[model samples]
Target: MPEAHEDNRPLIERIAADIRKKIMSGDWEPGRKAPTNDELQRLYGTTNVTIQKALRILKAERFLEGRAGVGVYVRNERPQTITPAHYIEPAAAGQSYRWLTEASKRQQRGKYRMLEVAEVTPPVEVARAMRLEAGGTAVLRSRIGFLNDQPAELVHSYYPIELARGTRLADRRLIPGGSPALLEEMGYPTRSQDDEVAARPATTEEYVALELPGDVPILEIFRVVYSDDERPIEVTVIAKPAHRFKMGYHIELP
Candidate 1:
């Protein structure tokens, strides 16, 4: 419990803010029990309903979790960091999975299930990004990536059907060194990438696929990889649960 704010802000909001700060500042360790409801009530000198409301706010933010018979505790939510460098450097041939190499470096296991591979009419945006004509077919590689056994991301990659024909990208199995390496071998080495990121409510499919909380939003990334000639080689649309990832970037100022 904490002292109520002197301002007109709701008492529950003030109490939640205090507890949030404590948790973020490491005053409360993950998986450790948070102050009991009765204790919070006493600390804030507030009613039981106010204390409960405060706890509810923290729980919704995934900073806390309540047990049935037990008490509420801080949540052990570890966010994976994503950086541009991960995609810039293609993994070597005969190496571990390229798409997950970054996670492996962070000591987190990454695995993905290839949901489907088919040649279909590309979505409007995908066609525009990949420079394909309307109703043109593209090879679609759909996958779901998991981190520590939890669903983490949904990736849908589209490639020119002619370019991927008879290639592993059209195969149902996972590519040995990932698509980037294979593209390089085919003389379409990725020279640069463009990424557009946005945050929005998770769709039904995304929510179910990522197993995200109802209140959590999704981070959508539209990435285009280009060849030396600046031709778009591939377009990948990625959806990730907002709470499970932290995007990072390091720029060198000229």
Candidate 2:
């Protein structure tokens, strides 16, 4: 017997873990009916209550869904893969609107709504990333991006007021070719970028905006773009539903 099957953990926990492994390994595929409680009880020589408890655990983790009169089954939804190269490599090739381009490649429609654009006091973190003085103002461009009509990400881009004044970045309309192209035209070509990622419970506004499930966490990405001279050109904050994305990176070793 495998050690996991023989461990001293609670029998219900062990049973749940076994079923979870099977589901994840595709031994039991999505939308397939899970073993009935009676069948699990017989196989494990456990009581109905014990089997029920195990099923509850899987349901809570969104691995299974019960149809009451029907039966429990594995969830059909899967996370989408998001590799760093999807954005970075394209940008390196001078392709703008990378997000939209990626969506189109996946046969999904991508669109964005420019929510707001105004000169506002920058958030402390945004100010620090843009190297602005405390309480300094910046041009804020807020947008909501959608994939196949589903909200996928909320992005807020900040630019130094002096750099953005009278520029498309300060406009309330969608900029053709994206902001990067406009910045390049203004002599601040992007040279490099840094990204910081983290996960946390979604805020109320985020939950509503992304139409996310209760208690689901969100992936937060802070990206800072710099010019050839190392002057910060832009800072963008992105919020995405955690389950909707799987971030990846590729690096070469020295």
Model 2, residue 98: C-alpha shift (Å)? 1.2
Best by lDDT: 1
Worst 10 residues of 2 by lDDT: 87-96
In model 1, the clashing pairs are none
Cα TM-score per model: 0.82, 0.78
| lDDT of each residue in 1-254, candidate 1, tens digit only | 99986777899888988887777566887789888888888999999999998888878878789999998999886455678667666678788666688778778799999899999998899999988877889999999999888898999999988899999988999987788888888989988999999999988989889987646778899999999889998999999987667678888999
Error of 2 at 107 (Å): 1.7
* lDDT score at residue 110, model 2, on the 0-100 scale: 94
lDDT (CA) for every model shown? 0.85, 0.84
Model 1: weakest 10-residue lDDT segment is 77-86
Q: Which stretches of candidate 1 lie over 4 Å from their true place?
A: 1-29, 32-47, 50-54, 57-62, 67-70
| Candidate 1 TM-score versus the reference | 0.82
Residue 90 lDDT, candidate 2, scale 0-100: 25
